[model samples]
Target: MGKTIAEKILSNHSGRDTKAGDIVIADLDFMIGQDGTSGVAIDSFRKMEAKKVADPSKIAIIIDHSSPSPNEGVSAIHKKIREFCLEQGVKLYDVGCGVCHQITPEQGLVVPGNLVIGADSHTCTYGAINVFSTGIGSTDLAAGMISGKLWFKVPETMKVNFNGQLPNGVYSKDLVLAFIGQIGADGATYLALEIGGQAINEMSVDARFTISNMAIECGAKAGLMEADNKVMEWVITHSKKKPNPQVADKDAAYKQVVEIDVTKLEPQIAKPHTVDNVCGVTEVAGTPVQQGFIGTCTNGRLEDFQVAAKILRGKKVKDSCRLIIAPASKDILMAMIKDGTYQSLLESGALAVTPGCGPCVGTHNGVPSDGENVISTANRNFLGRMGNRNAFIYLGSPATVAASMIEGQITDPRKYL
Candidate 1:
């Protein structure tokens, strides 16, 4: 009868003994909204006759999608968000501040054992640091904004153990893709994924974030990682709040258990139209590509850029291909510049966009033309994911994207390593 991490966190928030299938009204540590959704949330807030946010400090409004005012319509949304945040005394991250998923963690707005909700589906990204974060619709976002509380049905945990060292050029992205491909898109519906084991324990925080960021792709409620020293150190450095970390008890039960050995795992790719339509890199080798994108909430961290820079150094992007680089945040972009990662990528014919969602949301920035193929590090390959339903999207790791940018096709990343 031991409680999993999710149960323990919910119990703490709700002041009740909680478990899977139980519904609870819990206090939230943080709530977030982005330009794409915040305007609607603001409208909902006003419609509810809510005068003030329960806690302005805990609520954040970020303008990332359609950033820099892609068009007049989006510009009005940006203006509305800015005015709402300013009037409510809420924190606002304007254009170029980075994606909400990346900046929330970067700014230490989330911490271990915290219950968080955002209007964006990738809010599960915070689970890399052991926070119980999930996505909600704009209406739910407004409710949390006004009350600082939300209801939840505690989710059963799914334990995924990753052992063995990841081979060079094969990354956490590949490992997660392989898992998603195995489980299919709806496999973990409404389940909290607890990812751990030797490989995950050894991965850098940035890489771990990539895995958690895509948990939603498999229909997971949230992706949780153990708050080991590495995660603790990250939270300590980034977060001002004292950590209240939690780990699942040894006897805690899981709805399912999956084991993956990464010693020989290869670079994975998710073919167009679905994230779970995946295959080994060799399965689709030599597939022509017109774009190679290496940024998004999923893989726009500093580590991803370093890998891309290393691969593109002393080489050039294919003449027929366009390589687009986007850093996850202004901080990551600055770090890349200090270390020459930015320069390396640019010299190799890669075009650097603002440190935001870029073409991943299909708003502006780097959309591809009709009938083109794009190898990207972003999660999701659903039709029109990159702005055009006619263009195909292939999901891969940063190294895989970089390697493919050179060859103008789907090439194995190990070839560059």
Candidate 2:
């Protein structure tokens, strides 16, 4: 029997054959922790009484969440991380660097077929480029940091094939929302999602990153995309080393297969409270919104910003609504500035914040007021996700968020496009 991408990557890293449900100890190419989780991992590492990290170069600590120190408590945590990295010789990304998932790939730290783990749930974002990446708790992260190896239960694969071209005003975010709606929130619990097809292959690496970033929200172990020329080009541009692309065999075993025709798809929104509580844009049109946000690891790439700029140019954000734009990373923000997208957004009454998680994690910047409704491009929409238990968050694509920002309500993106 042939092996799926997850199985093959696990096998290669474990130095043994692997398949679904197999418990294997695999060597890690990289391990990451952000401010929110790294402190716990550090405590655990200290409790273990290890003198040195197994490989300092393989471990990275980022200060993204609560970046720039929202309060003294967060500042102390940042201080601890900086001190630990300095003492241990581990790579450290300071505040304003961006979300860990975005910076990890942008810095060329990830490569195809690499087995990566992080304390952040969205670590699976690396899988966008064919890496076998997943999230773990602080203790597990500490163990991986101390030993450079971690145990994993190989998961069964689910194959999702996207056929046909995506319609105008639709995006990878809409497709992912529609998919999550079909499968429900826990539909693929702990399963490896191997996503491909003409639509995925045709998508840019940034779009693929958006898709993979949300795999965790769907209750997936990881999301893997086949590494093709586009991925190779991205890797080459980001890193001096070339990737040895991994492709699933034709007969690879899959627990289930889902085929989606993108041509018939429309803009999708995950209504308040649950990511799986989805509906087409038209179904919820005219729903009032007090705020709109377009940023996060899931949809804060340059392409996303460009889409927002295209829609907001020469127009003003609704007077009743507040629009906030955050680029995923410093590079993306710089790119937007160079291309005048930032200026267009600013002129249209949108506020551009620093390149970081920014309101997505509810730490700081753009938190909603009580009883407010927000349309955002972030992945999750659970209650209190944006700092207030009473505020509601609606998830949509960038175009959808931008259109809704202009209308001060939930509106279909096609109208603006």
Candidate 3:
């Protein structure tokens, strides 16, 4: 029988054949930890009494979350991470550099057909480029750091195929939100999501990154899309490295298959308090919002900024709403500035913050007040995700958030487009 992309990648790394439900020890191309989790990992490494990392070059330590030190406690944590990286010779991306997910690919640290593990759940974001990446706990991360190998129980694959062209005002965020709604929050727990079809093929690498980044919100172990010509081109342009994109066998086994026609879809929103609590934009249109955010690993790319700029040009954000824009990485921030996207956003009354995971975890930047309503492009809308337990967060595409910012309420992006 043929093997799915996940199985094929795992099998290759394990030096043996692997299939669904198989347990194997696999070598990792990268082991990543961010400020939020790296401290724990470092402590665990010391507990294990390891003197040196298995491979310093293969380890990535990022200080993105709570960047710039939200408080003295976080600042001390950052200091420790910096000290550890210096002593261990591990690559460190300091505050304001960018989120780990965005920088990892932008810097060529992650590539096609490679296996990566990170202490952050969104590590699955790397799968956008056809890598087998997943999240692990601090202890597991420590083990991977010390030994450069980790055990895995291969997951069953769920194939999600997208067909037709996406309609105007719709985006990968909408499509993925619709899929998550259909499958429910726990629909694909611990299963590999094999995303494909004509629509996915036509999407840019940035768009694919959005889909893969959100797969974890639907309880997926990992989300994958077979790398195509576009992916190879992106790899070359960004990293100057030629890529060997992986492919699933022609008859790859899938536990289930889902088909979506993108042409008929509309902009989607995941209402406050739950990622799967989704509805078409029309359903929640006109609901009041107090804040708007556009950035995060999920939607903080250049394309996302372009869409927001196009919608906000020559218009000011609503007086009642506050809008904050954060670029995913320093490179993306610089690109936006050079392209005038940043100016347009600022002219429209948006505040541009540092390139980091600000406000996404409620550490700082745009946390909402009690009982306030927020519309953001970031993935996940769980209660208290953006600071206050009483404040509500609604997740949407960049266009949707921009349009709603202008209106100070939820509005269908089609109207603005």
lDDT of each: 0.93, 0.92, 0.92
Off by over 4 Å in 1: none
lDDT of 2 at 313: 88
Cα lDDT of model 2 by residue, 1-417, tens digit:
999999999999899998999999999999999999999999999999988999998999888888878899998899999999999999999988888989999999988988999999999998889988999999999999999999999999999888999899889999999999999999989899999899998889999998898888889999999888899889988976556678899899999999998999989999989999999999999999999999999998999999999998889899999999889899999999999999999999999888888898898998899999999999999899988999999999999999998889998989888
lDDT, model 2? 0.92
lDDT of 1 by residue, 1-417 (tens): 998999999999999999999999999999999999999999999999999999999999888888888899998999999999999999999999998999999999999999999999999999999999999999999999888999999999999999999888899999999999999999999999999999998899999999999999999999999899999989989989977999999999999999999998889999998999999999998999999999999999998989988988999999999999888899999999999999999999999988889999898998899999999999988899889999999999999999999899999989898
Candidate no. 3 TM-score:
0.99
- Ordered by lDDT, highest first, the candidates read 1, 3, 2
RMSD, model 2, all Cα superposed? 0.8
Error of 2 at 56 (Å): 1.2
The clash count of every prediction, one per candidate, is 0, 0, 0
Cα deviation of 182, candidate 2, in Å: 0.5
Best by lDDT: 1
